[model samples]
Target: MSTVALVTGATQGLGLALVEGLAQRLEPEDTVYLTGRDLDRVGAAVAAMPAGGAQVRGELLDVADPTAAERLAAQLKSRHGGVDVVFGNAVMRVGPDDDPRRIVRDYVEVNNFGTTRLLRAFAPILRDNARLIIVASSLGTLHHLAPSLHDRFDGPGSLDDLDHQVARWRDAVADGSARSGDWPGFVNIPSKIAQVAAVRILAADRRESDSARGILLAAVCPGMINTPTSALWWNVSDAPTPAQAANGLVDLALGPVDPAHYGELVRGGKVLPWSPASGRATVVPYAATTASS
Candidate 1:
């Protein structure tokens, strides 16, 4: 049977790029589901692909809706019987300019929730050699926010160490920290902690399932591309269009696979060493960090 793949947030940006890449890599026998919040945009994206001669279709999904992932899974199960690969790429964010707390919450809802939801809803349809690809940002890394109180749950180190820190913020809000337009924000450090924690838990769960014998699960950060949100950090440079990033995503999703690449993060077609001890995802150039702050 030909492979079947589903990519959420496929209207534009990285999601759109992934669709294009999948179009080129997947054979006409395979199927790629392009999804987005807007039906028209999803349709446009599907229409825009180079007709991989494969069965490419559009799915209107708004990951913000708690039931969106489940609904999509149901539709896919009925039409395709099973899905071989799933890319959880939709993300939600707040803040006019990618504020840390705002970004944190948004990432929790879409990135975190979307991942868990899809896995639960589609678990039954996943075949033996299936794959699940998660697109994460380097901002979530402990090294990225090194020396700061940012949370990291995949460890003996997590926001649990800074419980008091969150309490302080809550107290600040309660005591009126924002002086009417001073910008009041709540930092639920636990959320970020949980988001990263989910990654390891999910990977382990799939590995334990007999039904997923050779399934590959991974999380990757496509080098900060020039998406609208990223533009806030620095003038996008050496940035490949979403199209280029999608190529890497597709490679990981369906191009080829080796056991070593599983659970690894790749950039520009190479596996990036991501040990927290060495500040894998955390370390970055001064300019990028400065822009984020």
Candidate 2:
């Protein structure tokens, strides 16, 4: 059987570059599903691949649609039985100057909630030893959220528990008290924070429920890539090209799986300092050390 993989938001930017790199390493008969919201763009992106070993196919997917993730999961399961690799790279970027309400809406609807939908739909269908990679950013630090809410994400919780945290954030936004509630003034920080935290929560669940599967899950920060979307936030002239930033992701998938990086946000082989410690998730010092001090 062929190695099966799926890359969401694969039409352009980091997603496109990941597809390009992963294709180069696959053996003949390897199947890749590169997806995006627009069928035209998806076709063009797949058609424009560098003619690597894998058979590249275009798929139409908008991660934000409530039913889209589950529907796609069912189709893939029926056709391939299961998938070996999954790149959750779909995202919506926002400018800080955008309307406060709109910024909140875009961040929650597309960046944050979209990820949750994918996790729910795909987690069960992952093949043994499969790697589930989420293209998160370096900005996902717990320091951005209030210390009071840190426990909601850091330890022992179901998906429902983590989701309630996001609900509280949305509720705070609705009432104009997000900033007062110790949420970051800028919306992107909390969104990314939640993204990585979700990875940790899901990883823990997988370990507890089905320890034999060897499903490697992680959130990777590709760093500042030189792309139009990245240009919106900072100068991209000196940033690494998308192909360059994608190397880590491709390597993580093709290379050996190191359990240390699993369930953490890794950049350039080092776990981001703020991500929880080995086998535990938390941005702050461990409880025992804090209590003893």
Candidate 3:
């Protein structure tokens, strides 16, 4: 039996990279579902693939839009009986004046909510040993971004970080230390802490799932991958190619799960430390305000 997988935000960055890698690793009997908002790019991606002998196709899905999730669910139900793997990879970022709050909200909506939508829609079809993976950032790790005194905080702390960052910006603007236009706030350590917390929540959700067995789910740090998404980074050209990151993700997708690896953030295909406790994930300082929204 071939394993079928679905990936969102599939036109570029980590999403597209994973699609390509899956094409190589999975069999022709297997199917890979690729999704994005741009229909043309989706078409182009399908046309450009090297015949993996596997059934590879693309679907247009703007994960942030609730309707799109419904449409996608119907389509999946009609076509593939169910999916063996689902990679909740889509995410969107916004600026100060953007709707629905900060970029973190958008990220959570697409990365977190969008992912859950896919799983819920396909719950009936998910195989006994299916895998569910959510791509998450290191910024969400509380230990790395929150004050050491706040070590006791966990999932809720992640949401609080967003509130804290916004408050900090208000204070900064009032003090004449920051600009007033930075509404809903600036990127700070707290935002990162929240993001990591979101990832942990995702892992926990899968761990408690009774629907699948030997299910492997994790949040990975692709490690400074160079793509159009991060073009502003000065060393983008020097950074590892998206293909490199995709390859690493493929390794993770195919690897066996050790209890120790669950809820872990990986770099260079190995889990890394996020705090002094070791083997924890760390977040790089905020660079793109766009990354935080």
lDDT tens digits, residue span 146-165, model 1: 33333334442322333334
Q: Residue 27 CA error for candidate 2 (Å)?
A: 1.8
Question: In candidate 3, residue 17 scores what lDDT?
Answer: 80
lDDT of 1 at 159: 26
Runs in model 2 with CA error above 4 Å?
208-211, 275-293
Please say which candidate is ahead in TM-score: 1 or 3: 1
Tens digits of per-residue lDDT for model 2, 1-293: 78888899899999998888888889768988999989999999998998758988888989889789899999999999988899999987765355455456656767777888888988878888788888887878665445666665675376667777877776776566654554555566667888898888888777644346667788999999998766866799999999998888999987877778878898998888654334343333222111111
Q: What total of clashing residue pairs does each candidate reach?
A: 2, 0, 10
The predicted structure with the larger TM-score, 1 or 2, is 2
Between 2 and 3, whose TM-score is larger?
A: 2
lDDT of 3: 0.61
Could you give the candidate ranking by TM-score, starting with the highest?
A: 2, 1, 3
List of clashing residue pairs for candidate 2 = none
Q: What's the TM-score of every candidate structure?
A: 0.74, 0.88, 0.72
Cα lDDT for residue 79, candidate 3 = 76
Task: Give per-residue CA lDDT, model 3, range 129-169, as digits (tens).
Answer: 66666676555455454243234335243433433543454
lDDT of 2 at 145: 48
Q: In candidate 3, list every pair of residues with a backbone clash.
A: 28-53, 28-54, 103-293, 139-192, 140-195, 140-196, 141-196, 273-280, 274-280, 274-281
